[model samples]
Target: MRKFLALLMLLMISMNSTAGLVNAEADDPVLTSEAAVLMDTQSGAILFGKNAEVKMYPASLTKIATAIYAIETASLDEIVDVSEEIEKIDGTRVYLNPGEQVSLRKLIQGMLINSGNDASLAIAIHLDGSMDTYSKNINEFLKTNIGVEDTHFVNPHGLFDENHYTTAKDLGLILNYAMNNPDFREIFGTKQLEWDGESWDTTILSHHRMLKGEIPYEGVTGGKTGFVDQSKQTLATTADNGKLKLTAILLKSEYKRKIYEDTIKLFDYGFAAFKSSQIRKGETFTSGNLKFKASEDLLVTEPVEKGKRIVDKDGILRIQNGKGEIIQAIELKPLIGKKPEAKTETAPEPKQSGLLSVNTILGVVVLVGAAGVWMVNRKQKKSRRFRSR
Candidate 1:
């Protein structure tokens, strides 16, 4: 009977969630891009999407994944000797010359900051030693590590290869994952970086207009841009307004103007629709004797007054909206009070003499000294009396 009730509750929750998610995107902005998505980066909630899952070319937005993968898989301080492969890359170049040495971090900076294709090649060569191996490894890395599907990468740089393709939703996942890493986020957000390399002596500026202040948006934090004849234009942008941090992905936008327009609109919609609700660390919820607390502060984005906190038998906190959709499930860590630190059988300390105490010992010492003085004076008096007799 209990099982039946639990099952019934789950079914109701599922139905409500489906309704809520469908209703939430009902008024999503009409985007000019073939595929686009807006997400709350902190909560990993999909606020709005249009054809987000539809397979499309991601163009240079692929670099977001590449940059992260390199950061994790390769040593940033490891210096790589530029190879002939770097020389052969066609699109953008940081003017990296063959046989010249540069740190892996510098190459990543060039790749992300300047969209330097040659920089991508240099890092690829240094990490896996060949593009063929790098391609296979990076595919597994993206799928396994970043947990993205419906995407395949043929090259590290987002060039127009028939095999290199990703969806807007996938790019959203990639950027969100990348932004979590401090190293990647620092490089990703950089508006400008100096490239004092063996060949290039100039500063590499970000192509992202909003980040660079070419185009102004109130909360525009960081962004990446990409273009090819077939892909048209692709953009991955991030914005934060105090509580809420959002990432927007635009793929196959008809024009450059359309992508930015769509991005701004998406961010505005996210900020207006949702806010970050944080559950403080050590906050407790209980199921029987199993008390649970959030390991750290928990964040979720949803319209106000719409959230429902549901704790199950297993200590999982499924936070649903009023509409019955589970927006976030926090793995509530089981809080068991530390086993009264194992009542170890420590032997009681041996009893010391009462005289061991300061006052008692001092009193005994004074009494002994008084007795010795009295004996000495009596003996002297006796000796004097005997001498007198």
Candidate 2:
């Protein structure tokens, strides 16, 4: 009875602990914004969201798609001349005069850093022969490959067009894809850009102030900022707090300070609540199934990184195992043929020899017997002749 009571008491304690963790996360204050979302970049898991699917003007954030498309379709060293049509488009400009030539690399920088509408137009014109074609290509790419359904683009630059809009979730997805591309990530994370005697710096002091120690948040790697009367002060940032890396998106906030505050709150909540645990490494996960010839399994001859986490409800509190290690490897053994049949103890018979068969031995015996009979017949004839003499 005492043992049963002790087990029951332990169960109760565990349940209570779990409930407290859940409630602590559920009670976290939601930031005020038209739209917001927090996500884990590696796992692609959404941690928190409010109106995440509502479409709104993206402002300069459209440049992320434009840059991705341009980089893929054109070489960086290729020269592009500014067209008169590109010069006439409205919104931000890198002040590229008509017929001013620049490398595709520089144009990408201009489009991203300066939010240069002109550069966006030039890239579109060069890659697709017209802005309309470029818009169609970007739409196709987003729908077929990037899986961003809530976004639509009528212009390369994120100017306030009735057709230009994306949700916070979709924007996050886009940025996630863009960040995977080295060139796009480097350009977007850059706070300052200079080329061809021209320079553009982020209008917002730090691209990621919460991560910059301006607002007391850690793990701010880099991100992008967006603003327009319609979009307000919008920011998307990625931060790592040792164990967890979080992507936070905020839209239509009152001011830059409010955006940073909201971001910091979300990041702090994530860092305190959850931790990154790598469940499987690419090689480790794939090596288990590798088959040599027709065999089903093979030994894992190579080392692989394995990791995972025991995260709290909010994904903070990285539980350490004394060594600060969260990953380990699993070795796999190879499987040969099927198992032998059960209960048949007798060993298999030895294979037959090809050199001497039963027929060959019998034939040799018959020939020797016939030769002995012939010799005996000769001896009898000789004895009869001697008796006749």
Candidate 3:
């Protein structure tokens, strides 16, 4: 019977959660990009999405994943022997001469800051023996570490490959994951770097206009740009206000200006409409008799108007907007032990009879015992003094 009730409660929560999202969708900003997603970096909540899940060519956005994957799996200071393969890369190049020795960190800077295809190939080959192995490993890494689905990469750089594709939501997830790492964040946000490569010697600048202040926006932090004939123009951007951090992914914009405009609009909407809240560790939520608690501090995104947290029978926490629209859901673990309040025992009132209450009786006995010890000590001291004289 209890199981049945739990199931019924779960069904109700599911229904309510879906209704909230549908109602909230009416306020989402329309965009010109073929696919777009705005995600809260702190909470991993999708603030707005249009065709977010649809599979599309990621172009150079693939490098964002590559850059992060390399950062986590290997040391940035490790030296890499640039291969002859870089000479064959048709797109952007850092102009690597075969067998040129470069630090892993510099290669990543070139790949992300300058969109260097040659640099990407060098990093990939250095990490894994070949592109085939790199592709397989990166796919697994994205799924296991970042928790992104529907993303696949055939190359380290975002170049046109019919098989190389990812969703806007996945890219947003990747950027959010990457931004958490200090190393990745520093490299991704880099605007310009002096390149003293074997063949190329100049300052390389970030292609993303907003990131470089070419197209100004408040709170812009890190960004990546990708384009090929197949994937018109793709961008990944991260920004933070004092109140909230955000990741925006825009894919397949017909024109470069349109993609930047869409990204700006997305950021403006996310900042204006939503705010971040946290679920503190040990905070408890109840549904009927079932109880759950946050195991650690968990950030949640909500509308500026404020929202309510609803706990389902299964311990799923749903944050709902003022209009009863659901914006984010988090899994809460079952509480492990009895609550502190439950362990407390209330004392019974003292009896009305002449006899002292138990606590008062104990206190009197303790005082008497202390006095007796003091008297004995005094007597012993007097005897010892007399004997010494």
| CA-lDDT, candidates in order | 0.86, 0.70, 0.91
Judge candidate 3 against the unseen true structure and give its global Cα lDDT, from 0 to 1.
0.91
User: For each candidate, what TM-score against the reference?
Assistant: 0.73, 0.64, 0.79
Q: Tens digits of per-residue lDDT for model 3 on 1-389?
A: 99999999999999999989856533667899999999998789888889999999988888999999999999999999999888889888888889999999999999999999999999999999899999999999999998988988999997788898899999988889889999899989999999998788999999999999999998999999999999999999999998999999999999999999999999988888888887799999999998899999999998876567899999999988767867789999998775667546788887666555776888999999999999999999999999999
lDDT of 2 by residue, 1-389 (tens): 99999999999999999988765532354686778887765555556677889998877778878888888777999998878897578876777777878899888887776667888888888888876888899998888767988988988878777888988888777776766788876776666654453333334233455544566655677666677787888888887666666778888897888888888888776666455543322222222344212122321111111213233332232322223443222333333346976876888898767665777888999999999999999999999999999
TM-score of 2: 0.64
Which one wins by lDDT: 1 or 2? 1
Model 1 lDDT tens row, 1-389: 99999999999999999989866632458888888888888788877788989888877888898899999987899988989877678888899899999998888899999999998888888888888999999999989987889889888888888888888888888888888999998999999987797767998999998899877898887888999898999999999998799999988878898889998889877776677888899999987767888899888676655666778889898867556877667788888786666666997999877657887878999999999999999999999999999
Model 2: residues with Cα > 4 Å off, grouped in runs: 1-26, 197-216, 281-389
Q: Say which candidate scores most in lDDT.
A: 3
